[model samples]
Target: MKKILIAHDGSKSSDKALRKAFELAGKFGSSVTVISVIPELYLTELMDIDRARILETLTGETTRTMEKIKASVKDVRTVRTMIRQGNPASEILDAAKKMKADLIITGSQGRHGAEKFLLGSVSSKLVDYAECSVLVVK
Candidate 1:
């Protein structure tokens, strides 16, 4: 693969996926792009909150997270990090399409019960809709 995209959310499963992506990148000499998305502020919409301030705070947090990820994978050449705001699955898919990534790696959130049934996990959504190959790490 020439380009590999990783969907990371700082969970244990996502950390495993990141390692796997780095390993594959090392083997194939592929460029790696890590993307983290901030979900829409649905709850904040209901509350009397400063939407812009909340969004700004979230953006800063996401930036810090991406920076830490970049530092952790400093050995890997051609590593890129991106922060997006929207539905995680949709944003990730869009990023992959824009980057022309050959592979998309993401971690399973392991949501169960009503939540999983009502709203499918991000990994599942990406696997079902992504045009490119998707690897869902547990």
Candidate 2:
């Protein structure tokens, strides 16, 4: 692919996906964009102060994750890193569309049983809704 979009959250699964992206980039001379999203709950759920604190903390973590992603793809010539606050699937899809990525890659957590039922997987959601081609790595 000429343009690749990778969704990362600093998890091992995401790390693997990142490595795969780099491999593809190395092979085909593709440009990759890495994105990390911090879930932002509904605004009315918490007081303004509490919301600020949570956002601040998550923002810090987002920064760290983005930095790590940057380091991982440092040798790649056309890699970019970004941080967004929202639902992971939505953010990823939006970014892919914005970047006009030919391929979208993400990691699968493989949450089964009750966990899968309770909290829908981001990868699955993206596969269902994303307009571009997606690769969900294990």
Candidate 3:
């Protein structure tokens, strides 16, 4: 694969996916783009006025997490980091298409039944919408 996109959320599942991406990249010498999505919605009781501050906090956290991943990976291959504000699934799919990715890797919490339906799993949505091959790591 020329380009591989991985959705990362700084979780163990995502860490597994990153390792898988590293393995594939090593095999094919593919460049990897790591994406972290920050949802824009606040809690029902949260004030809109504080949205900017909250978003700033979230962005900083995400950036730090990506940086940690980069450091741990240790120049394994070409890596690009992205932090986006929006629905995770849609943004990931859009990025994959825009980047012309041949493969996508993402983490799954492995939800079930009502919880999966109500929450709309990002990994599930990505598999449904992505044009390229999607690997959902458990």
Candidate 4:
């Protein structure tokens, strides 16, 4: 694989997936792109809150997370980080396609029961829609 795309959400499973992606990238000499998505705030419109402030807070948090990831992968060659605001699955799939990634890796949240049913998993969506091969780390 020449390019690898990893979706990280600051979760333990995502950390594991990031490690796995780094291992594969090392073996294949592939460039890695890590993406963190801030979900669209549908409720913000209804609530009397400052949309820009909320977005600023979320962007700040995502930046901190990405900074940590960058530090961890400092030894790796050609590691890139991105922060996007939108649906996680859509943003990730869009990134994979735009970057022409040969492989897309993501961590499974392992959400089951009603939660999974109500809020469909991002991993599942990526697996179903991504044009490239997907590896879901649990």
Q: For all candidates, what are the clash counts?
A: 0, 0, 0, 0
Q: Please list all clashing residue pairs in model 4, or write none if there are none.
A: none
Clashing pairs in 3: none
Query: Candidate 3: minimum summed lDDT over ten consecutive residues — where?
Result: 110-119
Please say which candidate is ahead in TM-score: 2 or 4.
Answer: 4
TM of each candidate vs. truth: 0.85, 0.86, 0.87, 0.87
- Residue range 64-90, candidate 3, lDDT tens digits: 999988887753579999999898888
- What's the true lDDT of residue 6 in model 4? 95
Alpha-carbon local distance difference test for all models: 0.84, 0.82, 0.84, 0.85
CA shift of 54, model 4, Å: 1.8
The residue-by-residue lDDT of candidate 2 on 80-113, one tens digit each, is 8888888888999999998899999988762232
**Predicted structure 3, TM vs. truth:** 0.87
lDDT of 4 by residue, 1-138 (tens): 899999988777788899999999988899999999988888845554677778889899889989988887844689999999999899999999898999999887732323533423888899899999999875
Candidate 1 Cα lDDT to native: 0.84
- What RMSD does each model have against the real structure? 3.0, 2.9, 3.1, 2.9
TM-score order of candidates, top first: 4, 3, 2, 1
Per-residue lDDT tens digits of candidate 1, residues 9-125? 767678888999999998898999999998888874465557777888888887988898888874567999998889988999999999899999987663232342342378889
In Å, residue 69's CA in model 4 sits off its true spot by 0.8
